[model samples]
Target: MSKSRIIGVILALLGVVLFSAKAVMVKLAYQYDVDAVSLLLLRMLFALPLYLVIAFVKRPKDPEVMKPKVYLWIIGLGVVGYYLASLFDFLGLQYIKASLERIILFVYPTIVLFISRIFFKKLITGSQVLAIGLTYVGVVLAFSLEFSLEGEGLFVGAGLIFLSAITYASYIAGSGWLIPKVGATVFTSYAMIVSCICVLVHYSLVGDFNLMNYGMEVYGLGFAMAVLSTVIPSYLVSYSIKMIGAPSFAVVASFGPISTILLASYFLGETMHWAQWVGTVLVLVGVFFVTKKD
Candidate 1:
């Protein structure tokens, strides 16, 4: 491989690992009795300044006037993808293990495929159909195991994460169209900033501001999540896609679940079953097939 290719692979792997660590960090933060919205608020709050800086810095020098519809599209994608998806993910993580959360969230690609088919009238190839089937089968297998282990909250947790996947899929589907128009850096930064504003608004309406009065450990975890999981990986994944292309990064990102599983085991003491292992493998395989270039 060429030097750029090697760096791209490394960046892709590192980005996936950092993104996977997000769940583990959230689980840790929950040890402080923070609600989902509050925790999410803390994360976005820290990330807000960074995104603001980038949004201003990287904005076009000679900005073209955009249609009002384009601004609406960016705002809508931001709400669905980051704000809602993240809220659901954090709530689900309250009841589910980080490992299972990662597994469930990893199915967003298949969800995106279906979203494209339904909304955009994109053709669903035979391989995509098979990929979708395999991905759900794995989720079912994993959900069953989690249900047996976690009992009551299993359905609720799984359901929330599934919702998260759907919302994220919608974001991906919309972003496919918008990113080309907006440019990746501007689209990402602006969308995240918009999402951050939505999160703040939501927190103000329903969340306790006192929830911000936590110990240093909780604050530290939130800071780490903002920098490591949210901001850094965002750029890293974008750069990796720029360097090696999205298809290759998608293939390499299959390792994300494994990284989460291992991190959960070490940090959260979450044990994995054989069924989970099998399910993880199936999901990754399904993703591999779906993400492979034509």
Candidate 2:
């Protein structure tokens, strides 16, 4: 691989590791009795200013003027990808283990493949079909394990995470073309900013405005999540996509499930059964095949 491709792979891997930490942080914050909306609000609230500054400082000079529909597409994708996807994830984490959540979310590679096939008329190879089968088998295995252990709300949680995967996959598929046109930095900043505003609006309607009730630990975790997981990985994934395209980026990020499982085991004291390990390995292997070049 060329140097830029190598760097893109490294960035994608690092971004997945950091993004995996988000589940652990969300679980930790839940320990403080914070609701999903409140926690999400705090995260976007802390993240909004950073995105604003970056958007201003990195604004492209003499940029190609985009049509109105392009701006609309960005906003639509921002809502679907970050705002709704994140809301589902946070709410689902309330019911499921972080490991299980990560495993389910990792199925986005298959989702991305299908989105490309359906919307873009991309052909799916035989290996890609095999990859999808293996990936879903792993997801079902993990889901069954979680269901056996935690019966209540397991379906709901898994369904929510699956929805999250679809929305996120849609975002990745759509952003593949948009990023090249608008530039990675500009695309990421604007998408994130739009998501932040959507979160704020959502909070205003349904969330309690009394932020003084939560302790500093909640705030600290939120800020850490915003900076470490949200802002940094957002840009890393964006630039990685710009360098190597979305499919390769997804392949590099196949490490996400294992990383989240390890983080959950260490931070939240969540134990992984031997079968769970097997399922996780299957997920990683399947994702590798799904996105790898023939």
Candidate 3:
């Protein structure tokens, strides 16, 4: 592997690690009695300033490139990608165990595969094909073992999470245009700013803000989610794509649940079941095969 690609992979892994902390923080947020929209609002609110600083420092001229068409795309991407996607994700999470939800959510790799192939006409190689298959099977194993046929709520939740994955995949694929041009920091900042707007508009419409009056702990966890989960990983993944390309980057991201599960075990008192461990191995192997630099 070239040095740059190696560095890119490292950055991507770091992004994954930052992302793994998301569930725990959300779990913590529940103790403070915040709903999803308000929690999301707070997160974006905290991360927006950071993104602005990064955007300004990294690339001032980038904002000038936000043409009218780009603005439309930005709105579409931000609303559907972040605001809606996040809404669906948290909704699904409420209905299922974190383990089950992560399993459903992480199938985003398969969504990315179809999106890249159908929209971008990116051809899949034999190894890439196997890697993709591994990705699916791995996700199924990870999630299915944790899955329960319990409530109608879980089924409904799974559907929403699947939708969340699709939207998130769209964000990943569509974001390529902006991330490379704007630089990771700047693009993330703007996209997040856009998300904050949509969320605020929705909050205003529902009068959810009146219910969202929060104390310090709520604000702290929300900000932590924004900075630790969204902002940091958003920039890191963009940087990874710039260096290693999206397919390779996404393949590495296929390993997201491993870190999440591990952290859950240590901090959340979750157990590491055998199936989850096997799924983690499969994800690592699939990522290795898919991302092996030629």
Ranking by lDDT: 2, 1, 3
**lDDT score of residue 71 within candidate 1:** 82
Model 2, residue 221: displacement in angstroms? 0.3
Better of 2 and 3 by lDDT: 2
**In model 3, what are the clashing residue pairs, if there are any?**
none
Give the higher-lDDT candidate: 1 or 2: 2
Better of 1 and 3 by TM-score: 1
**Whole-model lDDT for model 3 versus the true structure?**
0.74
Candidates' RMSD to native: 1.9, 1.1, 2.8
Task: Order the numbered candidates by TM-score, best leading.
Answer: 2, 1, 3
What does candidate 3's lDDT look like per residue over 1-294, in tens digits? 999999999999999888768877776677677777777777877887886787567664645776778767777788778888887887676666565556667767667667878988977679877876886677667667544544678677778888998998899888876677656666676777788787778777774554447888888888889888998888788889889887788667756777777777777677756876787667657655655532
Taking the tens digit of each residue's C-alpha lDDT, what string does model 2 give over 91-166? Answer: 9999999999999999998998899999999999998899889988888877777766778799888889999999
- Cα deviation of 175 in candidate 1 (Å)? 2.4
Over 1-294, each residue of candidate 1 has an lDDT whose tens digit, in order, gives: 999999989998999999899999999999988889988988999999999999899986655735678788989988998899999999999889999998999898887777767887978789878987898799788778765578888888988998998898787667766766767788789889999999999998998779647899888999999999999987777667667765577788899999999999999999988988999999999988987743
Best by TM-score: 2
Candidate 1 C-alpha error for residue 222, in Å: 0.6
TM-score of 2: 0.97
Model 1 error, position 251 (Å): 2.2
